[model samples]
Target: MPTGNTVSDGVGAFQSREQIILKDKKQLDCENAQDDDNDGHYKATHPTSYMDTMLHLFRGNIGSGLLAMGDAFRNGGIIFAPIMTAVLGVICVHAQHILLNCSEEMYRETKRPKPPGFADTVSLVFAHGPVKLRFLAPTMRAVVNAFLCITQLGFCCIYIVFIANNVKMIADQYGITIDLSIHMIFVIIPVLISCMIRNLKFLTPLSMIANVMMAVGVGVVLYEAAQDLPSIQERTFLASWQQLPLYFGTAIYAFEGIGLVLPLKNEMRKPELFQKPLGVLNVGMAVVGCIFISMGFLGYLKWGEDVAGSMTLNLPRGQILSSVVQALIALAMLFTYPLQFYVPMSITWPGLRKRFGPKALVAKELGYRAIMVMLTFVLAQSIPELGLFISIVGAVSSTTLALMFPPIIQLVHEGHRNRLTKYIVIKDCLILLLGALVFTTGTYESLSAIIKFFRKES
Candidate 1:
C-alpha cells in the first residue's frame, strides 16, 4: 500500500525488517552481492532508508568549502558573487534534475534497476565502452577523476592548514609563539585519528558536529558584525559593486557541495525520495551562504580592505567573543576536511585499485593514504596562509566541479532536442565561463603575490 502504487502497477514484494538489516555483517558485504540485473545495476546490501538518503544528500553538499566565500568576495567583489552564485545554483539544480530524469529513463528502457553507487549507475546509462588507454571515452573519464581527486585532496589539506593557521593567529594575539611544527602536529593528530577509522557510519556524528559548528559560527559572526556596524563608517554601495567579481567566486564555492550526492540514487530505499535530501542540503547551504554574505558585506563595509581571511580580526581586539568565533571557524573547517577528501577519494579508489590491484591489498590503501597525507603537509608548509588557500581551492576546483561538470554532463546525457536541456546547456556554459574567469584571475593573482614575496625576500 505504498502511496505511489497504482491499480495498473503490480503489487510489489514486501520484506521483513530483519531482512533489511542483515544479521550477518560479512554475508552482507558489497563485493559478495549479486548484480541487481544484467543491465549493470547491483543491489545494495543495506539500502539507505529514504530519510537517511535525504540526510546524506544534504550532508554531501555542505562542507568546509564555504570558508572560501569571504575571500572569493574579497577578490571578485560583492556584485559578482551573489549574481554568479544564483546563476550557478540554478544550473546545478537543473543538471541534477536532468540526471535524475536520465536515471528514470534508463530504468524504464532497460527494465533494470540502477546500480548502488552513483558513478556506476550513471556509467551504465551513458558510458560508451571499455576505456582502453587509447580511447577517448577512457581518456575523458581519467581526466575527470584526476581533476576531481586533486581538487578534493587539495581542499582537504587546506582545511587542516586553515585550522592550524587560525590557531597560530589567535595565539599571536596573546603573544604566544607556537612553533609551526607543533601547530601542524595538533592539526594532523585529529585528522589522522579520523582518517584511520574505516567505517563511513562512524563519521556521521562528526558530520553533525561540523554542521552545528558552521551554524553556530555563522550565527556568532553575524551577530558580532551587526552590533559593531553602528560604530563603523558607512561606505558607498558602489564600491562594493566595483569589487564584485573577485568575491562572487567565493560565494559560489560555498554552495559547491550541493550536487555531490547525485550518484548515490540507487542506494536509497525509496529512490524517489532523493529530492528531499537535495532540498534539505540546499536549504542548509543557503542558510550558511546568507550568514557569510551578510557578515562579509558588513565586515568589508566596516574594515574596508584590511579585512583578512578570518573576519574575527576585524572585531575589537579585546573582545573575547570574537576570539572564540575565530577558533570555532577553524574547528568547523577541521571537521569539514574529512568529507572533502572522502568524495574525491571515493572516486579515486575504484580507478586506482583497477590500475594497481585488489582492494584487499594493504599496500595500495597505505600508499594512497600516505600520498594524500603528504600532499596535505606540503601545502600546509608552503602557503602557511589560510584565506589564500581557500581562494585557491574555490577558484580552481569548485569552479570545475560546480559550474563546468553539471552542464557538460547534461549536454552529453540529455542530448540537444529537449528545450530544458538546451536552456540548461546554454545557461550553465555561461556560468561555467564566469567560473573559469575567476579561476584564471585568482591563479594569476596568487602567482603574482608569491612572485612579489620571493623577490622581496631575495
Candidate 2:
C-alpha cells in the first residue's frame, strides 16, 4: 500500500537503486513533517537564475502548438488576427501573474507547498483569509487541473502528430510514398528518447532547436512580408470581407501557447531577481505573433490558404532549401513534443511518486509515456484529419485558464472591497463572457465541421 512518501517496492522497479533510497528519504521526511504551513526545504535547492528561468519559460510557453498558427490563420483573417492575439496575450500574462501571486501567498499563509491543483491552491489561500470561498475553491481547482490535463496531454499528441506529418513531408520531397505507419515511428521514437533520460537537461538542445526554427521561420515570413509590401495597399485595403475572419483566427493560434511559462518563477533559483517572467512572455509572444501573422499574411498573399502544415513547405522547391526546411521543421516538432509532455508530466509526477516506489518509477513513467504514444497513434491513424480540434481545445481551456482565472484569483487573494470590486469584477466578467462566447462558438463550428466531414465519409 502507498504511504505518504514511501511507495510499494514494485513501483520503483525501473528507478535506479540510489533513486529509491533518496526518494524514500524525501517522501518519508515530507510525510512526517509537523509543519502543515511550512512547505519545507525543497525550495532551497537548485534555484534557477531569473534570466535562465525566463528563457526556459519562454520556450515552455510556445511548445509545439504554434505549428498550428498557419491553420488558424487559414480560418480567422489577417486584420483582426494580430489584434485578437495581442489581447489574448495580455490576458494570459495578467492571469499567469495572478496565479503566481496567489501561489506565493498560499505558500506564505497556508505553509503548504504549492497545492496539488493550481486553482484549488489559490482558492484555499483566498478562502482562508476572510474570503468566503464556500463553493468556488473546489470548483475552480477542479476546473484548473481537468482542463490543464487535457491541454497538456492533447498538446503532446499534437506534437507527435506534427512529427509524423513532418516526416511524411520529408519523404514526399524524396519521391517516396510516406507510410501510414510513419505516425507510429514518431510516437515511439520520441517516447523512447524522453523515457530513457534522467533529467530535462538532455532536451535543452532540442528546445534551442525549436527556438532557432521559430526565429528563422518567422524571419522567412517577415522577408516574405517585405516582398509583399508593394501590394500591401491592395491586399490590406481590398482583401475581401469574407477572408478577414479566417486570417484573424489563424493568427490567434500562433499566440495560443503562452500559458506554458507560468511555473518558472517558482522553479527558478532567483525568481525574485527577474522581476517576473511577464516581461519575457510579452516580448516572446510579440516576436512570435508578428512572425506568425506576417508569414500567414504574406504566405497567404503569395501561396494562399491552401498551404498545409507549415508555410515553409510552400518555399520554392530547391533540393537543398526544401530538404533543410523540412528537416528543421521536423526537428522543431521533435523538440516540441517533450516541452508539451513536460507539463502533464509535472502534474503527473506527484501521483507517480506516491503510487510506485522510486526504483520502479522509471517503468511507470514509461508506462505513462506509452499512453501518450498511444494517443498520438490514435490521432494520426484517424482518417480525415482535422486541424481545428486544437483550436477548440485552446479556445475553451485557454479562455478559462487565461481570461477567467486571473480576476478570480485576484478576487480570492484580495477580499472583495465593494468600490474597487465593482470596477474590476465587472470588467473581468465581460472579458470572461467574451472568452466564453468565442470558445463556445469555436467549439460548435469545429464540431459541425467534424460532423459534416464524417457524414460525407459515411
Candidate 3:
C-alpha cells in the first residue's frame, strides 16, 4: 500500500500526467492504505459496513430540520408540502450523484483516489482542469472551505437555539420566566464540554443514543399530531404563492444531507454500493423524505395554522408525554452539537496548528472548539427565531453547498462540446437556476420574517 509519503508525492506531481498514470498502481495502494487506516480513525480491519453508512446518513439527515417541516407545510399547504418534499429529495440525491461521479472520474484520470472531504474535491477538480482555470483552484478551495465552515457553524447555532427554546418552554411551565439568552447560556456549558472531544469514533455511542431519542421523540410527536387531526374541509389546499420561498427554504434545509454523503461513502467498506439504484444514499434519503412528508402533512393537518417553529412546541404542554418528547429532543440536540462542531474544527485546526506548532495541537484544537461553541451561542441569542434562522442558513449556506456546487463541479469536469454533454449541461444549468431562485427569494423571505418577528418583540 502507498504510504503517507507516496500520497504526498502523488499530490505534488499532479501536473505530470505520465507520472500519475505510472503511479496508478501506487495510488491503488493508497486507497488500500486509507481503507486500512480508515482516515486514521478506525482500525484498518474494521472499516465501516454498508449498513452502518446508511444508518449514519439517515441519522445525519433527520435532525432539527425534521421538526420544522410542519411549519414549512403551514406556509405551503398540503398540496405543495408532499410535492415539494419529494422534488427536493430527488434534487438532493441527484447532486450527491454528481459529486460521486465527478470524484470517480477524477480518480480514473489522475489515479489519485478520491478526496476525503468536500473542499479537497473542489480543489482537485479545478486543479486538474484547463490551464487557464488552474490559478482559480486555490480560490475555489477557499470558497468551499468557507461554506463548509458556515454550514456547520450554522448547525451549531441551530442546536443552541433549539436547546434554549425547548428549555425555556419547560421552565415556563413551572412558572419560571427566564430570558432566552439565559437559557442559551445554561446550555453552552454542556456544549463546550462536549466539543472538547476530538475524535469522531469516540462519539459513536452518543450518536446512537441521539438516534434513539430522536426516533422516540418523533414517534410521540406523530402520535400527538394524529390524535387531533382536523377535517379536510377545515384545511387549506394551497398556500399563497409568496410563501413558496419559505417552503423552498425549509424543504431544502430538511432534505439537504449532501454534506454527509462524501464522507460516508469514502469510509464505506463497500464504497461501490453507495451509488447503486437501491444503494445506501438513495435508500437512506428515500426513508428521510418519506418521514418528512408524513410529519409535515400529518402535523399540519392536526395543528392547521397554529403549528409552532417545531411541532413539539405545538404539543399540549404540562402533559408527561409532551414534556418527555421535548426533553428528549433537547438531549438529542446536545449530543448532536459536538458532531456538527467537529467539521469546522477539523477545517480550522490545521491552519491554527501550523502557526502554533505541533506541541500545543490538542490545546489549540480544544480551545478553538470552545470558542466556536460560544460564538454559535452568541449568534443563536441574537436571532432567536429558530425556524427563520434555520431557513436563512438553509437558503444561503446549505442550498449553496448542496444544490449549487455539485452541478458546477460536474460541468467543469465534463467539458461542453460533445453531443452527450448537451443534455447533461442543460440539466445542470436548470438545477443551477433553481438553486439561484431558492438562494435569492428564500433568503429574502427568511430575513424578512426574522425582521418582522423582532420588530414585534421590540
User: Considering summed lDDT, which 10 consecutive residues are worst modelled in model 2?
Assistant: 1-10
lDDT of each: 0.52, 0.50, 0.73
* Stronger candidate by lDDT (2 vs 3): 3
Candidate 1 worst ten-residue window by lDDT: 1-10
Counted clashes in each candidate structure: 15, 28, 1
lDDT of 2 by residue, 108-213 (tens): 6655433223544544655664445655655655566666656555555555555566566667767877574665574567565764454655655665566677
lDDT for each residue of candidate 3 in 352-431, tens digit (9 for 90 to 100): 77798888778777777778888988899889987787788888887898889999888777762232377888999999
Q: Residue 59: error of model 1 in Å? A: 4.3
> How would you encode candidate 1's per-residue C-alpha lDDT over 299-354 as one tens digit per residue?
65555566666564455664677678778767766655554555555655655677
Clashes by residue pair, model 3: 36-44
Give the per-residue Cα lDDT of candidate 2 at 202. Answer: 69
